[model samples]
Target chain A: MSHATRRNILKTGIFFACCGVPHTRAALAWSMSADPLPVKQVADGVFAFAGAPAMMTRQNEGEICNVGFIIGDDSVAVIDSGGSVVEGKALIGAIRAKTDRPVRYLINTHMHPDHLFGNAAFKSSGATVVGHHNLPRALESRGTYYLQSYREAMGDDLMADIRIVPPTKLITDEEDLDIGNRKLTLRAWKAAHTDNDLSVFDHKTGVLFTGDLCFIDHLPTIDGSLLGWIAQLDILNGIKAKFAVPGHGAVPSPWPQALEAERRYFDVLASDIRRAIADGVPMTNAVKSAAQRERANWKLFDEYNQRNAIAAFAELEWE
Target chain B: MFATIQLRNPLVAVVLFAFFGSAISSSAWAQNADSPESTTWSSLKGDVFGQKFIEPANGIVSIEAPKRAEDAAIVPIDLHFKTDAASGRIKTVTLIVDENPSPVAAVFRFGVDAGVTHLATRLRVNAYSYVRAIAETEDGKLRMTETFVKASGGCSAPAMKNSDEALANLGKMKLRVFSSKSSGMEPMTRATEMQLMIRHPNNSGLQMDQVTRYYIPAHFIQGLIVSQGNRLIMSMEGGISISEDPNFRFEFDAKPGEDVKVEASDTEGKKFQDEWPLASSSL
Candidate 1:
């Protein structure tokens, strides 16, 4: 039978399993309802709600992270809720507007606040939350600090219902979930962007969700190893994806090509640090002068480059 | 007080930059030249060394610290002396975080037991400023070296430890003496390395209590004195820049039967003193 026919049969089977009847249109309609945010249909079944490339602020209402959902024949899977309750609720609405399918899984791309704070909105939906093995520890260690800082930055009103909701299902290396006819692959990465970084790949559409791994226009922050990030990029370059959804910037960007800018930045950072160490330059001087050649190339280089240089210097000096 | 002196002498800026310009970035050097709050070497020399003439520490003393601090609140600084007891004994060494509210970070006065004169510790730098180390020889001659560091928010950063837990073990200390050989080798004729760790919150008054949501009061080690038997080895005047548990690693000559004594006092006037036999093998 054709793929569409098989999906139809599976949907019919699920409907019968839920309602004990062959044709229950009202029951299906009751399962899903809400106004979801406008999303771009990147692939056959993948929808992306791209966020603006800006820092989280009260005016932005913590909408500085990209989120989306994937639809399978029998169920749907949501990827990364937004930064706050308002964004999460809006995402839920967007999901409802698009499909009446029950969201079987809520996958958090990483432990960052902008990506995972909207987890509470999906709690009542009973979607099994999933993340990397280290996500729970990362959240536990930094959750309170992040909450206090975000509250100060976004104001109490915007942060009212936001609480750290850790992932219940941990992916240590790689795992595949069959939403229906489609299979979504999740892979946990080494200490790169953070200790708990994970990416999702849709087999049918070849759309890879690279959470904070690939930054297009937005300058990347270095909370993890600079060298480790560069190494991961090499592996990411080999992945065959029709389109890639980045953690920041416009989603569904062309794969492999979108990895250039970020890779170049890391390369420059590592070389500059190595040279500085060889020259017996102290961290103070290196922080100001290292990677200065890349200043004009990336946005927000001034704000984060120095901090990155400091971290790199400490690591490279010992080596 | 020296801020007024700098206004009168513009040449002091030129001279000060000439000394530190090669070690620090031009922008930082210019910032020091332009900043009215920036203390010139001569000004600090007069204030710290008084009438004593301070010599350049090109080969005599070297300081190892990050030019840009990874963590501004805890910047590790190592002071190494090239000259030994045969050349000229290191009598005293003073550490200064130039831009901190209390610029006088610490003062180490060595006695006869002073051996190798290699000292290392950590401190907080409140702003982008120079970290200067001045060492005095037994003959009353002073030598100085300074490195410009780029960091800020050190004085106000929160303590990493939980307040209640920190308070529970407050004033506790640990001492470790490095042995020349792992096993049966006899004690060396020269000085040996030793590290002292004190358990104190060293609350910077900037950290908020996570539970109470209130600023913890500033209570840190104000004075630390290390002695061998009746002879004084070194003393330190500490500030919030010292990490949660203040640590000091230095070198001293080990006299077989002499006892190593430590006396520390915090800002709240609580004093802690302990003694250990120098011959103890285990740390």
Candidate 2:
């Protein structure tokens, strides 16, 4: 066995001993992860962390996508749900511990599992699940099948327990919600990540939540349009925000720097796709080459290396 | 010092357990080895995806698929059998990714003599799961071999474009045939290697429509069929997990001058039709 195995067994032995009660332990210790997702205090009332127990999004740095929490005067709005119900409840619990005020708003950045699967957990507290209008359709059509699949893979204990309902509030182009002193401007960015990618900006804090549109340390996963996503990122870059909470990864200190990483990654992907088209390469070959080239040249390249490459190629070459 | 072996912090144990669990189940079914795990995974549990698998006593035909796929979402699956074209030994190829949410991906039945060895096609993989190919041979043995694939998070990815765009081009398809090396008959023999790119939203409908205040209605490709110059070669009916603007690669018997026509339609009024002209140079 490798050294990693030795250390893991030792660690489990310790954890198992501590909780040595006669009762049965649910699932893996994944429920009680020692280290919570690393976070950045982007603003006074907002905190950001990459989505986790390490969900390998085909985008972003070696990080678990992005999950954010923005506290307002009357209540709190969670930006993007976690990869699983377990993670979502954990986030909810953390928020509850910090303040007794019920989480009144649950805003999903997009519909990807990493960002939206946990929405079901927040619904019980009567926090309205909010997203673009197409969100519910996306869920209903492909939702049940995946739901059952997860029930099988993750042992159904977590999924079977929660009630996953569609979003209560649907925003079109832009919607304004009043959190008392704080005005949260929710803008519907069209056809970017999915048909329903939404961006949340707080005028008071100058904090913008650019959902999946912005990936700081990782490459972007393109399930939408190649050109459209890049354009959306450019538009986001133009927006004025003091601290930008991207869909995943660290929130860069200066908003522009964080935006730059996203813009740069998209640029690399587009140019690679353009070049592949120009070279008359097949989509699969082009996808593989682009991924391999980036893996060799880019930093933190291994994280999203394969998924980014194929998803981008498939989206662009489809036409 | 206390005597003990430190297995350290590693995901190896978890992965090993998963692999062991799946491998045993799949192998036991193929060999009828009396292993308990196989009995559970290959229960032929439902009508949609699972089909009863009974090995041939005469050993006339066989099927092969990956032992383990790299991704569960998009698994590369193929079916090969033995016989002559005159017997009409092959009728239809039924594909079942048993562990997928819906299980049944496609069912292809042939009309004219597709021969004993007509390779089949490819289908969407919803997750890391099991794939079973049930070929109705000329005689009648439901031979099946299954392999476990490790893939996840396919259904959650958004549609490839705006709902309008994906909907606008629904029912469109592109057929392409290419060869890695310059070879004859071998390329033609690999008709099962054809690629069909269809245009459809395959909307999981979980996506938010940025423009409308309410959720858009769910729409996706429901039925797909492929024919070689008026011969019914394949038929498929599936839900949205088929992937947005889905592309399906498959195989069927074709001569150098054969004109292959394809037609596909979804539940929400989207339809696609295309006639592919087979050329010697194209392969």
What TM-score does chain A of each model score against the native chain A? 0.87, 0.78
Score chain B of candidate 1 by TM-score: 0.75
> What CAPRI grade goes to candidate 1?
incorrect
Q: What is the clash count for each candidate, in the order shown?
A: 8, 44
Reference-based lDDT, residue B194, model 2? 67
Each prediction's Cα lDDT score?
0.70, 0.58
Summing lDDT over every window of 10 consecutive residues in candidate 1 chain B, give the lowest-scoring window: B152-161
Q: Write the per-residue lDDT of candidate 1 for residues A186-244, one digit (tens) a residue.
A: 99988777667899999999999999888877777665556678878889888898889
Model 1: residues with Cα > 4 Å off, grouped in runs: A1-35, B1-283
- TM-score (C-alpha, index-matched) for candidate 1: 0.57
Q: Over the stretch A1-319, how does candidate 2's per-residue lDDT look in tens digits?
A: 1322532455335433543322123312323432223334577777676553243322211135678777888888888767665556556644543445657789987766667666765656678889887777666544654554344334434455444467769988889887657789998877776777889998888988888777655555665566777777667778888877777556644686776765666677777876885554545456556745445434445434445555565566664
Best by lDDT: 1
DockQ of candidate 1 (2 decimals): 0.04
